[model samples]
Target: MSQDLLFQLNGVSKSFVKGKEEISIFSDLNLTIERGDFVAIMGPSGSGKTTLLNMLGGVDQPSGGEVSFDGARVDNLSESALTRWRAHNIGFIFQFYNLMPMLNAARNVELPLLLTKLSKAQRRKNVETALALVGLSDRAKHMPSEMSGGQQQRVAIARAIVSDPKLLLCDEPTGDLDRTTADEILEMLQLLNRDHGKTIVMVTHDPAAAKYANRTLHLDKGKFVQRELVA
Candidate 1:
């Protein structure tokens, strides 16, 4: 592995037992992601893009081989350990924003910190910082339903980064937005990757969204078949 390597997967494989047979998602997959890199995983559905992402974020274990992040063996960790590690090191953003409709933006962003020992004041400060970073500081008290789709997504982004996680995993972050709003969200992600040195791995089918990344990996049949450079 290189000095900058952030994630390493060696001989990784995943399969499910289907009735009387095994369905292999991927086999003998070896991949590396570098720190501070903005990477996009692009492939058709059922190509194991999200499965790979789940493994990277410690959500799923590989059936064989090792999944390592920052030199730590993620696949080998116990369930509790994995949960703790993910809470500390990984930030997740999904298609639906995943914010609680009842809570305002600041409280939603503060959710992750609730698991920590941070004081309420500290959590509020972190929430403020994250919202400011996403240019949504003014919307701190607005509920999810009160904001536009784009604004809600921005709040979701703020929530993800509040803890300063080492990796940000976004699954179709702009899938629910209009073209213009999607572009804006993508631009903010680009800024986080370029200006703030955030290492991000996003799974997106949109070619336009993938273009924001520094590199794109095309996955097929449990392997990365092509690598495209965008930056």
Candidate 2:
């Protein structure tokens, strides 16, 4: 294994039993992700892009193969161990800004830190830094309901990075915004990758959105059909 490799999925398969039929999401898939690479997974609905993201994030385990991260077998971990591992090594961003309506921006960004042993002062500083990174430092005290959709997503991004996780997994991070706002968010993601050296894997349906990534993998019926490098 090269030192730059961050994830290795060998012969990974995922299946679900729905009623009397068994549905295979991905069969015998092999993938490798390098550190500091921003990758986008693009496919139509039901192509299992999000499922693959869940696998990478350790939220879902493969049924038949191996998933390794930083030389550890992540797919073999117990549920509790996986949870702890995810908390420290993975950051997740969803289509919807998953912020609490009542909690202000700083508090929402502090939620993940509550799982760790950081002091209140440390958590506050982290929150401030994260919010600043996302260009929301002045809005740290505003409630989610008071912010626009784009601002809310920025807050969510702040929350995701507050812990400085190894990988940032985003499922449609700009799905709910206008084109201009979406472009801004994508630019921030680019800055995160280029300047901060954060590794990000995002799932997006829009071809324009996929262009922001270093490479895009196209999936069809649970299989990767193409790998395109961004020029």
Candidate 3:
């Protein structure tokens, strides 16, 4: 927890009780993510990529070790405090575009603001700007069913970024798209990383997707096995 580090995980470990057995996901895992770094986590199925992402985002707690963000221990925060902290600090993008079917694109993107104290006009302005950033200005009024898979995902990205969060966590962001659409999404993510200086930690199985990241951390059997820097 310093100005240079956005996240610091020291000897983090998580375990779950599966019936009568204990399943350990991570043990003594240490990691540090600097501000504005675009990192990709790659691992085989069940290697705990998602588990680590969840831990970083404050959705899950480590059974041991420490997780600190911006000099504060996140793992020790209360559930209510973590919820509030996540609203102001963290954004999440999932494999499926989790948009409300009843709301239009702009409204869906604005949903996060409801938790804030911003005025209606301010919320609308932020939503418009975020949609424009993702090149979806014209599609703001479209429903989820009215758009293509890629467009829906773009709306999801807009929603994630609308809060202007310092950190973005993505889990298989392009998992449900075609090759061309997935490439377009990856390019947009790269722009966010390079141009906007957003700290991104993404989990992906595709090597092509990993190429866009500044660094790739590979996990094996719940441990860091390899680290590669592209470019």
Candidate 4:
């Protein structure tokens, strides 16, 4: 393993069983991601883009081969171990801001820290820092309904980064926002990758959203068909 490498998938394959048939998503797939890299994955509905992101984050496992992170094998981890590993190492962002409707921005951002042994004060401080980073410090006390879509997404981003995870797996992160708001969210993701050294893998169908990433990959027929240097 190279010191700079963050994630590696070698000979990975995934399949699911339907009513009476088996569907293969990917076969013998391979990929590598390095530290501090911002990568965008673009593909059609059934190209397995979201599956790839899920596997990378330990939300799903390959049927064969291996998934490794920082030189450690992740596919072989037990359920409980994988849960712990994911909580500590992976942050996820979804198309719809998945913030708890009842929780305020600060509480939503502090959710990740609750899994750790940090004191309440420490957790509060971490939440404050994350909210400030996402320019939501003043809105920390606001409920999800009180914020706009862009502001809610900002809260989601803060929640994702609050744990200081090694990897951020984003699935259509800006798909729910307007063009201007989407650009703002993408810019914040770029800032996190460039300034905070966070490795991000985002799945987006929009080329404009992919443009925010340094590298863009196109997946089709269970394979990566093209690669572009967008940044």
**Which candidate wins on lDDT?**
4
State the weakest 10-residue window (summed lDDT) of model 1.
67-76
TM-score of 2: 0.98
User: Please, what is the whole-model Cα lDDT of each candidate in the order they appear?
Assistant: 0.93, 0.94, 0.94, 0.95
Full candidate order by TM-score, most accurate first: 4, 2, 3, 1
lDDT accuracy of residue 174 in candidate 4: 96
Candidate 1's TM-score reads 0.97
Q: List the residue pairs that clash in candidate 2.
A: none
Report the lDDT tens digits of candidate 1 across residue range 65-113.
9888888788989999999998999999999999999999999999989
In the order shown, the candidates' Cα RMSDs to the true structure are: 0.9, 0.8, 0.9, 0.7
List ranges where model 3 is wrong by over 4 Å.
Answer: none
Query: Any runs in candidate 2 off by more than 4 Å, and if so which?
Result: none
lDDT digits (tens) for residues 165-193 of candidate 4: 99999999999999999999999999999
Which segments of model 1 are wrong by more than 4 Å? none
| Residue pairs in candidate 3 whose N, alpha carbon or C atoms collide under 3 angstroms | none
TM-score of each: 0.97, 0.98, 0.98, 0.98
Residues 1-231 of candidate 2 have per-residue lDDT tens digits of 899999999999999999999999999999999999999999999999999999999888899999999988999899999999999999988899889999999999999999999999999999999999999999988999899999999999998899999999999999999999999999998999999999999999989999999999998899999998994
Clash count for candidate 2 is: 0
lDDT of 4 at 162: 96
